[model samples]
Target: MAFRVREFELALMHRMQDLNAGKVEEALHGMSASRAELRAAHAHWTRLAHAPRAPKGAAALRMALGAPPYRGSRPAGSLTCDVLRWPLPSWPGLAFEALLGPGGEVWNQWFVRPEGPMTVAFTDLTPWACVVGDLGASFPGAVQIEGPAPHHWTVDFPHDGRTYRARFVYGLIQRLE
Candidate 1:
């Protein structure tokens, strides 16, 4: 999953470069990717959206609770993708959207969803709650710094009679204990 997302980062970087070069036509107008490619991209993105950030960006988000800060190629930017129409309401339209930020890291990150992020409270998801990735449950605990963590942050939950811990940096999850 990380490998695929890492590759998607490259695709996003190149697209950003083209957009920055004022080549809107090149960025906006391009041959669509294959069905397999689209699935791979989505799989990669989903993992990144809930991973941990790096050391420098000093920005961290709880992967479980919501998407990170980067939805597209860059912060506050958007990306277009050619997705299959068979899955009803899986994403949005041919072009779903979310928000993205650099967070100073690469692999460990998260992004908003088709709509975007929202103000949330951590207390509601911790203590004795269950967070299962299989069911698409996110437990991005509360922000310890009251904002993006300079180094990292964490949230704990009770699942399967065990106390599970998730760490975050740059709005990504590094590990789960």
Candidate 2:
């Protein structure tokens, strides 16, 4: 999932660069607000690039929870993935998303569609919560509480067109560097 998202990021970067360079005009004319959200996502990925990679799944999970075993061989299971969109002002504020789960557990589903109304939703999710954080900040986002079982938690922002849909699913490594 992270791999795919990386590709998405690259595309977004290219698009943003084109827009900035005046190589590609935007359909929405002024999308500076949307661009800001993309910027946040870009910054978040830049930070993760410097973070130690967990060579094992266990290490990935541990790292997700922000635990010990500070440094050494990277664990395989402890991988963190961020698949978030830049929030539109007409919609909602920007959001930072992180998925932390066991290495083998895959969280696969799209939450929004490109050219459609923007919305956020989570389903068949466990750990009962998701943590949001700012760009490159060690401190995490508000610890959102979840209901029992795989519940569909969603947030609706303003929209002009039809409904948007995107899905994402990935695992978190359990160990640290």
Listed in order, each prediction's TM-score against the native is 0.24, 0.21
Clashes of 1: 23
- Any runs in candidate 2 off by more than 4 Å, and if so which? 1-7, 10-20, 23-33, 54-177
Question: Which is the leading candidate under TM-score?
Answer: 1
TM-score of 2: 0.21
Residue runs of model 1 more than 4 Å from their true location after superposition: 1-110, 114-151
Which tens-of-lDDT digit does each residue in 116-164 have in candidate 1?
A: 2333234433211212221124333322332234324455655556666
Write the residue-wise lDDT of candidate 2 on 29-133 in tens digits. Answer: 354335555556555545554567633333333333234212222233666543322222322332222232444332431223223322223331212112111
Summing lDDT over every window of 10 consecutive residues in candidate 2, give the lowest-scoring window. 168-177
